[model samples]
Target chain A: MEQILANGVYLGAQYAMIALGLTLIFALMNVLNFAHGQMYVLGGFVTYTFYGQLGFPFVAGLVMSCVTLFILGALIERFLFAPVIRRSSRDESTMLLAAGLAFFFDAVILLLFGEKQRGVPKIVNGVFNWDFRLIMPYDRILICVLAILSIVSFILFMQYSKTGRALRALAQDRTAAQLMGVNVDRYSMIGFALGAMLAGLVGGLLVTITGVNLGMGGPTSIKAFMMVMIGGAGVISGAIAGGIILGFLEAIGLAVLSQYGDITYLMIFVSLMIFLAIRPQGLMGKPWG
Target chain B: MKRRVVLKSAVAAVALSAFAAGGAWAENPVLKIGFVGVTSGPAAAWGISNQRSMETRAAWINETGGYTIGDTTYDIEIVSFDDQKDPKRAIAGMEKMAQEGIHYVVGPNVDDGAAAVRPVAEANGIMYFPYAFPKELYTAPASNAVLGMVANYQSGPAIYKYLMENKGVKTVAFIAANESDPLSQRDGGVAAAKELGLEVVSDNVTYQVDTTDFTPVLTPVLRTRPDLLVLSGVSPANAPQLIRSARELGYQGLISTETAQDAQVLQEGAGDLANGFISVGGASTPELASDAMREFVKRYTDMFGEYNDESNTKVYALEYILETLKANPAAIDDVNAFQATMDGFEAPNPYMVGDAKLRYVGSTSFGQKRQVAVPLVVNVYQDGAFETLFVAEVD
Candidate 1:
């Protein structure tokens, strides 16, 4: 049981990282960026090239991955999403566009990297043990700590910072904020960029844990969607709770059921249905207007 | 009237010349051989290795004016399809090959893909040389199927004996990916371990092929504290991750595997952690090479920049096919005769990997004539190189 919980906690940490970024985008944009997972994949590949292949410092690789995604995400918002945002059914159109971009990213990565799995070497090695049992790796511990710290920092910034306040104002009421002298376009682009940067940081963390492969994008995107939905769409705190729930369910299920661990997805879907039937607003989310 | 007669005669002469030219074209033809496998997915390395061997050999043969059968010689044209390691895609590739009238095929490397592809090839009367380890795919229903690689039945026992006698391994824990070949390997491995008097302390553990974190699977097995861990038929992409995870979890047991034949991948993925790991593959180093093997390694390295064990096996397959065709020319036109010839065929070249001569054998599960009894080499990774510890001869 201890082993299961330890593994579950680690899995939960990674899921929360991905879910946090995805939820932020939904909260600010009101658009489900289906390409969010592809951003994660691209970020990991960038880290792999920088730290794994080019022999750069791991911290440098992570920072560079964040910066690259920030710029790229801003450019995508400006060129692709800007013109489409004026439409009446912008949400559906943007979602479709995100899906198309996801496939396009996969194709481009496949062309460049070929379809082999690439790994980022562990920054720190060795295991921590309790007597003859309960062995946990230091790298996994580092992942959890880093993820929590990053999430908390982002939340604090959103609460206190001026730019973050502007972003939150736009998320709360875009038209009203615009009327009150908030630059709607700049805040929207920055919000998307911030979300992309978070996704990229999570990618760098995970590449060392699971290794990076091209096919990771599709499954990961689906998992992100599940996390967001289960937590209530457009709710940051809900995303965290939902991610941990799903992660623990998977890890504990695998520990007990072994080969039938995939049934956890079905269980999560059932839970989603129950949540919708009862408290559709989710644990930390307000009821939809 | 005289001018009209001359013109008619000239027209008839030109028509006669065209007919004669068409008749000459019928004497020599291009023989289309198809290769279907996972050429562009996570398992792409396996398919790419086979592709390198087939394409390199085909190029050499073409350069030398092709394979000669009696008085006529035919150029071998290789048509490749990437199945992406999926069964449905493999079947689709087979359908496409059938439409194109390709008579010979190289592989559908994975067991599930092989199962789907075999029937299609059999139904189309195309002779297929598969790289899979499954038994039933080579049976009566799929008479055209020929296994060019070693099966788990032979490898499982061979590995067990090596670990027991050579390494003095007494207890083992078995793990496999949840795929046709890996599952079959686990079944074979467990039975072999029991037969060899080695106690299996842990139950057979299985994980999905795409499983990233093996902690959930490996944690319980580590608690058993078995003397050895056997990863049977794990994909090349997953093996290193599982191995690293096991080591990191503080399981100080001897590790053995029967998959991921590429040494470069093992080294790159697991780093120094892979040292002392026992597996069933080796590079074509100088000492292990015969004259022909040396030539093959040199040519292959020149063409592709590196030589791995899969490259050698696939090359052996191409050699076997070419030699078989040269000996029995009629088999080129008649796939039934080709299948019969392959059923009883022995290695005509000095391709020494196993003990004695390499040949096809019958299986009770498949209940038909199939599978080559290739030598299973017990290789140990030490000091960044694979050293052959033992060669289990096939009887």
Candidate 2:
């Protein structure tokens, strides 16, 4: 049980980091950024380029990845999302636009990088002995700490910082906040850049554990959508709570039913269905305003 | 004077035409061969290396006055494609090759690539050679166009038999990727273990291709407390993660697999965790003392600047095909004649396993015995490098 918990915590941290970006984007733009996963994949490629190709330090590579993805996210919002949101046709238009952008980005990435998983150098090496006969890697622990820090810092930023508060107001009521002289367009772009940066950070962390491949972006995007839906769409706290719960459930479920052939996906789907039936608005979630 | 001038001009034109025809006939025919692989992914190392090795061998053949078929010598020209390890791409590549009239082609290295190209090759009457071990290729109703250089499903049983006899392994757990190819290889391993009277404790497969977090899978396998851990069809990316994770989890059990045996795989992918793992392959390490092996290695490194892999079985088989065709040019004209020549032909094991014989089993399937030998090289990772433990003929 302890072993399962240790594993679950590590896996859950990664999910939380990835989902935080999706949730943040949702709050700011009122549009689900499906292309969030492509940003994650791009983050991994940037890390690979800096560390593997340029021979930079692992941490430096990670920072470069974050910065690059932040700029890319801002650019995406400026060109792609801004035009669609300006028209304000319907919610479906936003979703369709986001989905189209996601496909386009993924296709571009595939064309450039080809379909291969590339490995990044491990940042930290060594194992941690928790108790008698229980050992885990320090990298996983670092990831958990980083996830916690990012989430806390994000919450604090939204509550205290001037720009973050403006972003939140814009998220809550775009038209009302705009009338109050909060630059709605600028905040929306900032929100996307922030979300992309967070997602990129998670990608860099994930590279320490697994390889970065072109196929990863699609799955990451799907998981992020599931996390956001489970946490209640556009709810900040809900995304975090939902991410952690889903991550833990997946990890523990995989551990328990490891003997069964090809049951992981089925188990996760069934669990999600049950959760949806039990709490329509999610565990810690309220209906979207 | 006008008639004389016209006759002279006509004679000059005829002479020019005759010279052109002579030049065309004199120049060696470029025999086009196709090579297919996933030239773009994490598994790119294997694909790249396979291409390099084939090119090296082709260069060597061309340099030696090319392949002699009867009175004609043909220059070998390889047409390579990046299949990306996608079955659709593989099929498309094979179809393109067939349309372009390539008679002999090598590769589509993995099982899925082979599966894609096999039917197309059979339908088009084009010969295809692949370097993956999947039992289904050998067991099914055979086709004439496909030839698999690696040993068949029987090799797994041979491996298990050897382990039970030598290593004293009683209980084993199988870890494999949850894909069709890996699943098939795992099934073969499981069947072999069962036949050898060994206890199979657990079989775990990961659905995700880039699974780094193996604790969910490995913890349960470790709990079973098996003496040996068998990995089936592990890709280059996942092999290191599994090894590292297992090591981190303090699994001291003997690890063995054929998939992670490539030298490049160990150096680039596995790193330190690769130490002490054992794997099987179709070729032995090149001995510097042997002129052929040394020259081949040197030329390969000179051309490509590194050892792409140590699998010389494909190269040797390819060379064997050339040699067979040379000895009997009539065989080149017909598939049956070619198979007959391949079956009858024997050469000194180019892989240098000692008295190992190469004979093509007459099967139409691409994996059919192009060459017959129990040429399995067992390599152990020692002192941060792969060293051959034993080269036994697995019957």
Put down candidate 2 lDDT per residue, B86-156, tens digits, no spaces: 88999998998888887566777778888778788777766666666654554445444344444435456
Docking class of 1: acceptable
Residue B48, candidate 1: Cα error in Å is 3.7
Best by lDDT: 1
Q: List, for all models, the DockQ compared with the true complex.
A: 0.30, 0.27
Provide the lowest-lDDT 10-residue window in model 2 chain A.
Answer: A113-122
Q: Which candidate is the best by DockQ?
A: 1
Tens-place lDDT digits, model 2, residues A43-139: 8888877886688998898899899989988998998788888888688888888888777866676556544456655667888877625678787
Q: Chain A only: TM-score of every candidate?
A: 0.94, 0.93
